[model samples]
Target: ILEQCYNLMDFEAVAKNTMKKTAWAYYSSGADDEITMRENHSAFHKIWFRPRILVDVEKIDFSTTMLGTKCDIPFYVTATALGKLGNPEGEVVLTRAAKKHNVVQMIPTLASCSFDEIMDAAEGDQVQWMQLYVNKDRAITKKIVQHAESRGCKGLFITVDAPQLGRREKDMRSKFTDVGSSVQNGDSTDNSQGAARAISSFIDPALSWKDIPWFQSITKMPIILKGVQRVEDVIRAIEAGVQGVVLSNHGGRQLDFARSGVEVLAEVMPVLRERNWEDRIEIYIDGGVRRATDIIKALCLGAKGVGIGRPFLYSMSAYGQPGVDRAMQLLKDEMEMNMRLIGCSSVDQLNPTLVDTRGLSMHTTGVPSDTLGLSIYDPLVN
Candidate 1:
């Protein structure tokens, strides 16, 4: 199986076959109908590349920085909940892989491993960001923030989209009950927590723009909003003095018909460039990112980097650390090849002139939902 694996979709197939039913459902399923989830990847098809020829493409470099944290690649392992559900080692396995690869890992607030457990797993001073879901109690939120700063978390990414977890029907149907379902490894999942919603209540819906200042005063970590969806929000994020914004829709698990992150990026970047504020804040997008071509498309359209969640989760769930290792390595190989083929030599060379976004808004609808093919096809794109 390891030798057979090629890309993210291959790992998804392995994960589907290997993961426990409940875990598979939670990791793979999206919101109602999953139109946005599938569209997340399909939206990339809309962008066409205008590859140039005869450039010095022998040595391709995709290394770059995010929020001032330099990484070996232009992507990071984005935050996702519940690692123990698929692997016994939990998020530490991910931490180890991230360290091995020298890319940033955004530790999830709802991780099965304790926050310190994840931080402690890092090799001395590896760049790790904290993905915070604001606790309803300000005191608890403050404590989490201060502790992350103490642990030397380099970036503070406040998730602003999901005030409430969406109705992930597949996860709901697959929720474990009784015996082992009550909890696993004695982590945060306590019955409903184990099932899903118990921790959802811990997140405060009242988190607002006014709260940004409070977050700033508490920690010196660069503050980034992770779910800004519109051009206006990106502008507001710049004005708010945050370090960056991730133009994401929570991997299309929040709203059923929400726009994909890349689509939103097409809308947001022009506004930033128009206002001469592109440099004011680092902009990124996640969701439907599967291939190196997707990464190039994003970079060409002006993203600092991308946040990838499920592919790594799928790889880790199926083959553990080695699976993750190969997944990232495959990306590096493809990134280099794509960069060479596209006639660019470095991360700094990617620009809007290299791609076309005229069809970004032409959302493809009425595509048939193949149940088995859904598992075999890209987990993100139906």
Candidate 2:
């Protein structure tokens, strides 16, 4: 029954009502009209599935690697700040569940759990990645990097796009300002206040592409830049020696009018091929990835793996760590089930050929043909 409900509740329901109106607005609201946000999911709807029948499936393996670290599934939870906003234990719950599921869980600098505490919670599972905001003060940013290294965090993911947080109308309309109220960061017990301070210190208004080298100089742990949407930035990331790039529109929480991460994947992949860096680095993404088939589509489209954010939070909010475990398990199970149905046995086998993109148009409005647009197998139209 829990599993059924989990599958039935889309991303919105998991977020609705549980979060205070203000926090919900902020976290759920995309940039402008949320055109890109809608498109991200809409684009997925445009692809049709062509599942091959008659495949033997006595056993299946959903395990794969990201930055060479083996994991139980092809997707991992992205680091989002203020878990306490959803549950009291906050980051601790997420870390424990992630460890149990054998997946990487990145911790935001604004994480409610102190870096050391969260690290300890992982119980020697160093698959955790630390997200650095790369604030104005290099000293502070470098210190956080060192802290992550000392805590055994496996990698550093620098969010390059947000110099200043975007204006989310939903949050504005929520008519409240307490996005982070449960956990304390500095002298304040208010998570929202702490979040404000954290972002203020680390979000350097002058941050630029050149600054990535400075981060590279400070730590040898692989650096992954999140929020990459354009091909030029992808090229720049490769030139900067980034180990990976998450093609994201900040989960449609950043740019409302921006292109969906899925739409951008098409543009980014060819440039990546041109760079001939496909063999040298990893390219992963997460946006509108609500089902097992969504994971398969991302992989087929050229993502090395996918990151899950809001959905995991929804699980955590609904049932704490157990619920999170269930969510992760369901995703892995769905991936396995979908893989068998499609006549593929592993994560690496999915590609453009597995799904059809014909006659599919994506936007905020409804798709031209639901089957044509969203099927794993391309739809045939006469």
Candidate 3:
């Protein structure tokens, strides 16, 4: 009845009314002011597609690989914890959907289901990546990474933005709690720590570039540092010897009024190219990718792929598995259609030249070709 009761658009409304108000707040609220959250969506609007006709795209394909793993599309189901709050099946249902879609599933450190349970649900049929939070103790962090590696998890994504949790006033006001939940693997689903208290409990806010090797020594799986917003940080990540970077601001769930992910993408990509690490490491963006066009825009700006969090959550909250499936299909369809319309036969062909960024300030001067201690040539769009 619930599945039939909601369409993709109606998922959020249904979830909000049916799910606990506090859980909804935790899942939906952004950082203070949500200024960046609002801007993340708006930045996509600022990019206009210059779709070219005369191209024969009788059949469109949305198949691509992320960081050497093949997928039905370019997007991944981002790691979010305590999905049981949204639906009884919890991460199991989400794992099944990602397995079915042939994409990646990031299992959060705060997952309500234990790693063993989530892996059992995966059934060795899909790629699962572990998302890490710097726990209060380095020993615990290493233990989680080792566990993930032992379980055949393909990669590790260390989310660095929340060394301390940000001020999510909405969630605080809504008063969410996970007291009754099983709290799998001794996970802390409560945000009572806030961002600061939470990180303070675990990761040292003073964590530095020197610590990257500390994590590297733990496992051979690829490491992707998420929440990289600055070029200097990007350089630090590269120096850290990680395999990839996911330019994000935690879906604007961390810092308020921070630069949207796209804005950061434009800045970081050139640095990668100039540093001669453009293809050396996988680069991805994930803040405001709500549509296929948004995905294409990121590719044009030089991202290997994009990670989508809230939109899929919105779908899951709205209609469970079916909503999740429908949302993935919509994004894939949009990407394929936009690619064909823009005369690009494949995702690989997408670049800054395919779309016009004439009105944006950064485009007024062409983007720099060299990034390290050198002047970059910012291009002018006519």
Candidate 4:
């Protein structure tokens, strides 16, 4: 059954069928009208690739370093909380798959398994990063960061986009309505607030630039600000002395109509180059990245790497660890094939000339058609 799934979108269709209604809603829904959610994927189509041919395409290399850590691929798994909603093993399934693939997994603060437990599940020398949803209490935040550092988490990815959870209408509707009958009863904990609100309630809304120094003082881990939507913020993140920035809109889950990460990357790259901060801080992006070609587009626009969230969750939901492993392998296969076709033998050979970005920043009305992602929105079966 798993072999029939050829791409990440196929996994979503299978996961939608396999998961409970509420779980599917929680994983798939974006803020308000989901305009930005659809835009994130559609934005990639606007950029046309200019692949070179007949340039000795043998020996394509996709391996690169993310924040100084060697990764076998150019992309890594972005953090998604409440993994138990998808599978019995939750984040641990991801850990095993990432370890097997030699890619980094950013453990969420609200993971079904505790931080230490996920670390314990890792094999020796498997690099992991911590994604922090800062608590309202400073003491709690301090303890969590310190603990993650002690446990060998290589970097700190601070989620700065969400001070409060956006109104994900599907999750909200699921919370008020009952879809529990169709959901499989796994080992997931029951929450009165449902998946979206339950884990996000403790997030510190007061998080601001002032907190960067406090975080710096607490841990020696490299800091990368996630959810930076503007070039201005990217400049602020660099001046604040952080190691990196993730150009993301929080998977379009927060802030309706916020620009896609790839769009933001296009706006930020030139400024970074002019300021000569390109090498000083690594830039990464997440959202609507389903294809290997999408990764190539972001890389050409100067993203160090890209992050994939929902596809991995869907893969885990449909086939557990093996599903996640297959998903990674598929991406690796695509990257190798695409790179060779683009006449690039290595990830470093990619540049802005490889793509046309004229339509990227233009915003259009209505949700663009995505049959695979839209499959999850069908009325739940009871």
Best by lDDT: 4
TM-score of each: 0.91, 0.86, 0.88, 0.91
Flag regions of model 4 displaced more than 4 Å.
Answer: 176-193, 363-382
Which scores better on lDDT, 1 or 3?
1
Select the stronger candidate by TM-score from 1 and 3.
1
lDDT of each: 0.84, 0.72, 0.73, 0.85
Report the C-alpha lDDT of model 2 over 1-382, residue by residue, as the tens digit: 3455556144347557666554565456676688777777777887787766676765778788998899888888887767777777888898888888898998877777777788888876549888877756688788889888877778888887676666556655555445335433323332342233323333677988778778889998999998887666676677678899888887776766666676667656654565465776688887877888888887887888888887877777767787788888778778887889888887777777887766343442242334322122211211
In model 4, residue pairs whose N, Cα or C atoms come closer than 3 Å (at least 3 residues apart or on different chains), thus clashing, are: none
Model 3 scores a TM of 0.88
Tell me the lDDT of model 1 at 11.
Answer: 97
Q: Superposing all C-alpha atoms, what RMSD in Å does each candidate have to the true structure? A: 7.5, 6.5, 4.4, 8.6
Model 3, span 1-382: residue lDDT tens: 4545323345557667777676677777888899888888778777776766787677777678887898888888787766776777777777877887787888877666778888888966588889887776788888989989999999899888877667778877765444336245433445463322222344557666677888888899999998887666776676667898888889788888777777777767665676677877788888877778888888888888888876667667667888788777666667777788888877776777776654443532244323223333221211
Per-residue lDDT of model 1, residues 1-382, tens digit only: 8978999899999999989998888888888899889999999999999999999988877889888888999999999888877888888889999999998999998788888888889998699999998988889889889999999999999999999888888877765553233222223444443255644666789899999999999999999999988676776777789999998988988988888888888766765676577789998999999999999999888899999999999999999999999999999999999999889999999999999877874442222222212122221332
Model 2: lDDT of residue 106: 83
- Among all windows of ten consecutive residues in candidate 2, which has the lowest summed lDDT? 373-382
Q: By how many angstroms RMSD does model 3 differ from the true structure?
A: 4.4
Candidate 1 off by > 4 Å: 178-194, 363-382
Report clash pairs, candidate 1: 189-193, 189-194, 190-194
